[model samples]
Target: MRELYVKSLPLQDVIANLAEAFETTYFISCHEYRINVPEGYGSGFIRGINFSSGFGLIEYSCTFKESIKIHFSVNKIHPLKFIYCSEGIIKHRFEEKDSLHLIDQFQNVVVASTAQNGHILLFPSGQKIHMNSLEIARKDFKTKIDCDLHYVDKNLRKLFRDLNARNLFYYHGNYSLAMSECIDEIKNNTLLGFTRRLFLEGKANEILSLQINDFEDDQKAEPKRQILRKVEMTQIQKAAQILKSELANPLTIKDLATRVGTNPTKLQEGFRFTFGATVNNYLNKLRLEYARDQLMIGDLNISEIATNIGINNKSYFSRLFKSTYHLNPKDFSKQISKNVLLEKL
Candidate 1:
């Protein structure tokens, strides 16, 4: 769907004037600017938080029955903004001449800090939109981050003073499993009052953190992937599907290539080219995500979930799970208690 790019700002500043059409539930605490707009222009909410560490978050999930182009007229240097689309379709463009980019299902786009330029997002008529938009103030994150944040400092620049350096940087990739789960948790969480607001705020932060983590992980794992033919790309994607669908049955590189009509080297190369990760690394990420999904459902214990995924050693599974998710299986389960109730209008 085509979108109109009227004058736009960098999302955060566009709030006070967010289509006076909707009746909104707005809340601001020491760390959050949480608002729920469920009336006037269809139903949805925009939840935002400014963390003490300098980075911040803003999440947008709405279903619109009308056509409107919300403008983010950039006045100052914009921070790094990450936009994720789990459902529906969205079109984005930095300037008038630039081709409009689409972030469809299971895809995300990153916009690096650059000269203050307007950006726009269109909610085409009759579209059910579900998306998460995160803004990270690089300067704030930089102050607290002693460890190299991969490419953050370099990729996001203050080009106003540095005339020689290019002014634009952007990144596009598949949405990670952790991000998907966090979005699901935000959309479905039923807690109320302070508890509900806090839960949503925490989950939104996780979405941003996971996406950055995945970006660096992918960068280190796969750099400078070789080009492939269209047909080879298709076969390689098939191998990826096999990995995603058959998580319990661990398939060797040769087996996957054979099943997809390719050799192991090509399989390995193509997996890197297509997903920015080797087959084994991609499989591990997917399997751990699968385990997380199982844990979220709360049907099985840690040991049982590990065995279900063909990991016989519960201790080993816990270690792997903790390394990736920053929390053990037991802790994660307790983190998502079923007692919380969803908020209703």
Candidate 2:
């Protein structure tokens, strides 16, 4: 096993420590530090950035030839960490503990160590792991935020308000679809320079908000059934793909649920939680969006375009289109044609 000790903070030092352990160089661009895996270590890169708001982000996307352990052992109070595993599995344990907590794909955890107790991350050999950590220097963060946190969820207020590092806290749960989307945006965004920093800070805060909201909702749920699970999210993703592909052949919620290997009630809840819309409502929205694209392309008549998107009735499609876009389908198509002609001239 290869052991790496990272006694650093504020993201930049963390990256520097890792780069030194691997004996490779790192680069900083737009306030983000990134290091590519050297020839001997495996493939992929690790990058991180820190914002002035006392929040930072670190991303690990790599595979190792041998099992690796990263030990974070700063002398001062450790920052609060919100960790998400998007691919493969990541095992984490407090520096003083022996047992480990597994964070699988689509799962997240909020962790705060009491005092200076650090964190240990384990990455198994040959596993391609993708994980993101959002760290907040609590003492610094509390000072920047408004003093009144009464609006914060009761359960989270203590977690967020504990600036003295007096308590240890940990909560593990599945990532909400909204949070997952935000993570994707943060990872894949291509904005540059000042805009990139602004975008990342905004997304980091958005993700933190969503994580807090999910934690609150999870706490409020009955113990018998946590509102969302990783498996259910997978099923919902499958169902969404089915809806998009099989639009012409609509199915009842029950049938769709069965096809996706989940129950109707859970399916409904999943759709509502993930997309903020009922199943039919989501389908209708998808259909309308597709119809608008076809209309703009001017490849099919209104009836054909409607049918293509699973609406068989031309008049009904026109009403739905008008309701959504404030323009009838035919008129919208005409406008597209007129714009194309004018552009050509």
**Top-lDDT candidate index:** 2
TM-score of each: 0.56, 0.72
Candidate 1 lDDT, 108-157, residue by residue in tens: 88865346665667666677777777665555555555464444534323
lDDT of 2 at 102: 92
Tell me the spans in candidate 2 whose CA falls farther than 4 Å from its real position: 222-231, 237-278, 281-345
Model 1 has an lDDT value of 0.66
Cα displacement (angstroms), candidate 2, residue 153, comes to 2.2
Worst 10 residues of 1 by lDDT: 156-165
Model 2 Cα lDDT, one tens digit per residue, 82-188 = 99998889899988677899999899989988887899999988999988999998877887665767777776788878887788888898887677778888879
Report the error of model 1 at residue 119, Å: 1.9
